[model samples]
Target chain A: MIDTAVLKQKLGDLDEDGVQALLDEFAAGTPSAEETQQVVEACQQGMEIVGENFEAGTYFVGDLMYAAQILTAALEQLKPLMSAGGGQAAKGTVVLGTVAGDIHDIGKNIFKALLEAAGFSVIDIGIDQAPSAFVETAKTNGAEIVALSGVLTLSIASMKETIEALAAAGLRDKVKVMIGGNAVSAETCEFIGADYWSKNAAAAVKQGLTYVS
Target chain B: MSEEKLKIREDLLAGRVPKRVFMQLRFTLEAACGLAGVDLVKAHFDPKTKLQAYRKVCETFYSDSFPIENVRWPEVYAPLGAKNWVMSSTGAMQHPEIESMLIEDYDEYIEDAFGTIMKKILPRIYPKLDPALPGAPLSFAKAYQRQQATGGEEVGAQIALSEEFDYAPGFFVGLFCEAPFDFLSDQLRGFRNITLDVRRIPEKVEAAVNASLPLMQRQAIPRNPIPGFTVFIPLHLAPYLRPADFERFYRPTFDKLIREINKAGMAAFLFAEEDWTRYADALAALPENQVIQFENGDVQKIKEVVGGKQIIGGFFDPLITLTRSKEACIDEVKRLLDIGMPGGKFFFAFNRHVLDIASIDVSKLVAVLDYVHEHAVY
Candidate 1:
């Protein structure tokens, strides 16, 4: 039996030693389904704490990435156990990439980790993607959402072009589009015909989840 | 020097408003020429035609811009070629692939500088920058070759144009030296890697930044101080870190760099990007009279935090300048002037460069300057 409160606190503090102690105990074999769920829940709660710290300015983007890595490491350790216990399938498919002419992907990569932890299958089309690629990926994967990421104002044109391409491909109504990055805003989303835009990776994951269930 | 240009420096140093508001419109020659209907690629080789085109664009579009003694005319008129003229070793013409990871292992980078940077890092990341294998280090030779290959023609053309220019010509000062963390995040390690490394191996990150300090100082420090000039330091990776992280990983080196730059009688023109509202207090503690150009932070909060010490230059939004009506533009400028221009140490600039000339209503820009000159007087 693991004390989840202690686990949550340690994970939130990013105390690798303390968090690893709990994860090690669970991964040592013979943990109940309840225990595995609790461990996953603790990681989720830890991410919420990170998001709070980020909003309060105590944690930066790099810190959030660190927290995401910890969750990823913990998940990697527990993946077999979760699978053996018949865990939930991926809730939805997400098509993600950095739009054309804008090559920044740090934010997009972080979002990918968080969304994957939340049990979404992400198809990253890589950076500097053409608008048609997003449309084609969504059509093939039957993706629930499309995420276009860029870190330049110049890419706003690309985002607009991507949405137009989706509509031209006659696949606009089937999938939701969320555009995000350091350079994107709600106004930019509207101008580019994206369904939404998020301020940070946490919100992006949350928003991506909403489109699924 | 012209009386107007002299007044900009005097007012800034003395902590008084200049006779008229000073405006720094951030535009590169390519974008400027593009706006003015000149093909920069063709014009690059055509030196005589290029100078005439530059003058025509300047007279037509940028005549109202505040003329500083250290005018960046060389930068404006300089031909596009191999970017290596500033830092030959870095190999300017080649673009680093955004998709690939430059440094796969942090330990390799930590264990050896020249060995990893030259043999492993540069060769893999930018083959053009890595001139030779480990046994024969030939960066200086490469620099010479690169200069002869690309620099002579453009340098001569730009110098000739500068010598005859009416205003004080600003020369290329030097390349930027990032605080250790920024150098890692920017060139060697990606942002994701550095962010993880800060927690996983704190000592290695600190060692890397400390080791790179002298190298950055070598690149950044000017040999001779140009009068009334400012070295533009684009502040990246700082806003991404928390207050404590910035203090530990960034601030000390940045403060040292600022102190050294000031010792040489020049100022650091920091393009303060992103939302640095959290670190405003920490930033306020830097030396006074340095220009802080805000891009996204709340101008009022920044004004309250660091306005008295630094020469605050912004709050004018480029989107407003470009997309909004002329009346909307004037209102925004007047609003910023009212908030920022009370006790001097304020200049006019946009958060980002107005890339599309059609987006800017030059008359509206003139109106803002005119309005500030008339009403926002100290």
Candidate 2:
């Protein structure tokens, strides 16, 4: 019904109008659930290219953010079409939050948008979230990956607490943990007991894809 | 003050090597409050108390001048119901990028950007600021006046201190200003909105950025240069842009704002607040006399790229100071001085902010500064 490869290229190209027009055109024909899933996977692949471009320094923080926005809106336009044929199944669930005592969210939001673009169903618990909140959400949602974000150095302490809570809840072994933000370092990551730490959102998304795949 | 201590500024401006490497540094509100053991909340409310604490902090550290203690009256914004510059967990006032206070559509803001700030956006950010809301016109005027009086009395005291205190290098007062990119995202569209708006409505975003610069500049830089004062701009959002986008959207206004300050014979000090390795050439492109404080970057690279045209500083890391052993911390200082000092234009300071006294080993911090004062000489 639509050239999924072309749509993916438009997404990687960050051609928002082109991506939207193509998605709208594809949806008008009422694609099948299986076919729509292919389109969605292609979009995710396009976002992978977007992430790659970001990693290559061709794109920037704004470009990654803008690409995610396009992916999000494009997904919404395709959602009903896939839902009518049968619901679009997310690759996996990822629980994300900025740990307690920090209110900064730009980094967290960027990570969330990119995670969503990579086709994971992300539950963003928002800023200043407690460890208990993370445990409860991960348990309830059966999240496979828990991503913690913060900007303040104080937030590393909270990230530690959140991970410990996950361990205490017996959910630690079940989920892969990623800690990120200005405050996070490999030293802090190892100390905090996170499985991985991302310096940028694109690398973080790449990690998310690795965990799910 | 001795001619030698103050001579550093003139030497730096004239592009000459001075007798000794100068020292200039800043601590965030939280760090200052925690270091002094002063009540953070009280410091936020009472300028006199904050200044006293600040003075003690400067003196205790044997600082050549006070840290940039430009609260510029944050409590004044509180009554206006400020969203960004509100109190934090430690009671220290900070402008965290929480929710951007501007919730209105871009078209209206795009149409007249500065006017939207005055008529619409400010009201949304500061809910208590309606002059026509009946009983009290902006209700905080009386309170603001009282606070100003208290602050004014302290500023008057600093003059007397300069005469008596040898450590006082006099105030290098700065009028705090925001770049249009910073204000547009921080105050209005925020990170997400502005991020998308660049792609979604490039024309509107450009219009808003272009229109807001003049208003931001007029309100920030002094027409006649104050003797020790400079225009301080903390570059926030520009680092996140790819150089092309930054040049298109931010470079012109940022360069112009600093150039005007320099043209008026006042040095404009800018805090290149994040990882700006990509923009080092762009940063070096600003007028050489104007000062630039880097929060993070290669000291050698900044010097090599800038070619000692400007006074270079701010590569000493607080993370190393607070967390590393005393020897390690001092080694980093020696490393910075080795790279930075040979030119005679280096300023000794921490690269990143030490947000509080929580992680600090005072002896280590003291040792680092003491070492700088001792070894970092021409």
TM-score, one value per model: 0.82, 0.89
What interface Cα RMSD is found for model 2?
A: 2.5
lDDT, model 1, position B230: 65
Instruction: Tell me the tens digit of each residue's lDDT in model 2 across B1-378.
Output: 767777875676566887777777666656667777788778766666676666666665655555545453565665677776765554545566544434345667667666767776666666676656663364568547756875675566555445445443422463767777776777677777777776667777777787778877786766665654667777888877867778877777777777766676666667777777778887778787566778777777887876467666786766554457899988888888888877665677666566666535677888888888887777
- Chain A TM-scores of each predicted structure, in the order given, are 0.91, 0.92
| Native contacts retained, all candidates in order | 0.29, 0.40
Candidate 1: misplaced stretches above 4 Å?
Answer: A1-5, A30-38, A82-87, B1-3, B13-16, B28-30, B33-60, B63-121, B128-144, B147-172, B224-229, B321-323, B354-378
CAPRI-style grade of the A/B interface in model 2: acceptable
DockQ (C-alpha based) per candidate is 0.27, 0.41
- True interface contacts retained by model 1: 0.29
Local lDDT at B277 for model 2: 74
User: By summed lDDT, which 10 consecutive residues of candidate 1 chain A come out lowest?
Assistant: A182-191
